[model samples]
Target: MRLAVVASHVIQYQDPFYRRLAAHPDIELTVLFCSAEGAKTYHDVGMGTTLRWDLELLQGYDHRFLRNFGWGEGFFRLVNPGLVPTLVRGNFDAVLFMTGWAWLSAWIGFAACRVARIPIFLYGDSSYVPDEKSVRAKLRAAVMRALFGMTSAFMISGKLNGDYYKHYRADPRRFFPLPWAIDNERFVEGSAFAPGERDAMRERYGIAHDELAVIYSGKLIERKDPMTLLRALARMTHPAIAVFLGDGALRADLERYASHGLPASEPPSFPVSQEAGRPGGSAKSRAAFVGFVNQTDLPKHYAMGDAFVLPSHFDPRATVVNEAMACGLPIVITDRCGPSADIVRHGENGYVFAPGDDAALATHLDALARDAEMRARMAQRSREIIATWSYAEGVDGVAAALKSIAGGEQT
Candidate 1:
């Protein structure tokens, strides 16, 4: 089967999946990027820095970069009028869109495919959440419902993401499991280390042998709620330290909070006030803010930590959670994360707390930090769970979806 994929740009996390799909013997795959954004150094507003992925994203895949004609960023920046002719020339049996209909390029591609009578599969990780009772929300819901109607099949990212389609009244039979996964083997290999190697990595990050190092890897932005992890760590009486592996707008505030312990009496807020904390220094360093780690070096960071934490206020599916699991670290994330529903089994692989509940987060951390046996058991379970959520499984699901569509079974 000849399949064409339309995506916003080449991403470090997504490159491996594309390569795996392209390597399939029965399928001919081509990825069409709307922009050459991550292929070179660019300013990332979320990380608040100019950076490029260290790994080459274009290798081992049949791909093309469409010429973009729009301005600004995100949905607005990706206006590629050249996609229509490119899709026409490819003459793919089916077109798979890696995103929704929020951008001009997607609508244009959808129109071209519709006119050509080609099956269109929508694949993304947008979960169903209650929207505000506003005019904008209503309009967006209507637009998404209309878009769902045009889709021939839905490549479901996870349970929550599948609910998004169900919420739009999509036929259940049209849903196919295209798990949001990483190159698990690469992560597992990169994370494997000898006793001395692990110790050296910990020493580089100033993570003491006795302290329970919690790894939080992502943009230190408001949505990620790094403050919750900071607050939870501060209140913990256990000997623990936080190893942050990304940068963002909240870096300065987090640094100050980490260096100076907060007053226990301060009222809890969405973003715990940076002003309320006094200059009382911590017993030792509470956290380390290692900024913006690249794709190749992530496993080493994951190796040095005992537990992985993602305290996002809202995240559809944080693939970093998957990466951490692949590295054999127990997870501690908020329910707002999409993977919490399926990948993370509470009390089995890790624990899940309500978003903004630092008290609950602190309790879970303390439990994992204090109990070596529990951590070991949970760590093993994490590896077992993530081992099933792999690129191979995703490719199989895609091929089955194609066959079903071709046989007039999935409509």
Candidate 2:
């Protein structure tokens, strides 16, 4: 089967899965990237820095970048005039749209595919969270029902996302669970450090052997809520090390909160490193702010930590949670995260607290710190759970959808 994938950009997490799908013997995949903004050096407002992905995104895939008439960043800004003509002439048996909202290119592709009588597949990560009750939201949902009716199949990220599609009147039989997965091999390889190597790496990062190291990665922005983690850590009396990876606009504020009791007007010591035996220093001083670590180097950082925390105010589906799970670290995520239900087995693999609850986050951290055996048990469960949510499983879902479509059974 010849398949065409239309996406706004090549994301770090999705790129690997696309490559895997391209490698299949029965499927010939062509990815249409609307913008090369992420491939080139672009300033990410979330990370608060310019980033060029270290990994090769287009290496092993049959792909092309559509001509982008410059508007600005994000999906709504993307204007590709050539998208419809390209899809109409590409002779693809099926077309998969990464997202249908906020992109003119995606809408055009959908229309062109329908006109050509080609099967339309949708892969989206949208969840049924922050339940909107406004009239605008209801009107949008009604419109979404019409749009989703044009598709042959819906490839969802998780159960929550499946329910979101169902909420828009998508056929349950046509809904396939193409789970949100990461490069598990890359993360597992990164986590497999020698005993002495793990100790040395932790020591270099100011994390002692006895202290529980709690690590938080992703953009240090307010929505990600890294400050909540810091505040929670500050109020804790437990002996643990707080590590913040990545950079953003909230850096100064987080650093101030980490060092002092309040957010103050002072330049933060970039990449602060504190030793174990400092004169008149407490465990709180062990908090380190390590700036952005690239994709290849993130595994070792995960290895150094006893647990991973993502205190996001709202996240559609955080793929970093999958990465941390592959590294065998128990997660502590907010309930607002879409993958929390699928990835986190509340109090089993990790704890899921309500968003913006600093005291609850602190309590979980303290409990994990006090018990070594529980951490080991949860870490084992994490690896086991993440093993099933792999790219291979995603391939199976795509194949099943293709088979169902070929059989003329679009329910």
TM-score for each candidate, following the candidate numbering:
0.92, 0.92
The Cα local distance difference test for each model comes to 0.85, 0.81
Off by over 4 Å in 1: 262-283, 407-411
> Alpha-carbon error at 380 in model 2, in Å?
1.1
lDDT of 2 at 198: 87
Pairs of residues at least 3 apart in sequence or in different chains that clash in candidate 2: none
TM-score between candidate 1 and the true structure = 0.92
| Candidate 2, 19-45: lDDT as tens digits | 899999889999999888777778877
Worst 10 residues of 1 by lDDT: 267-276
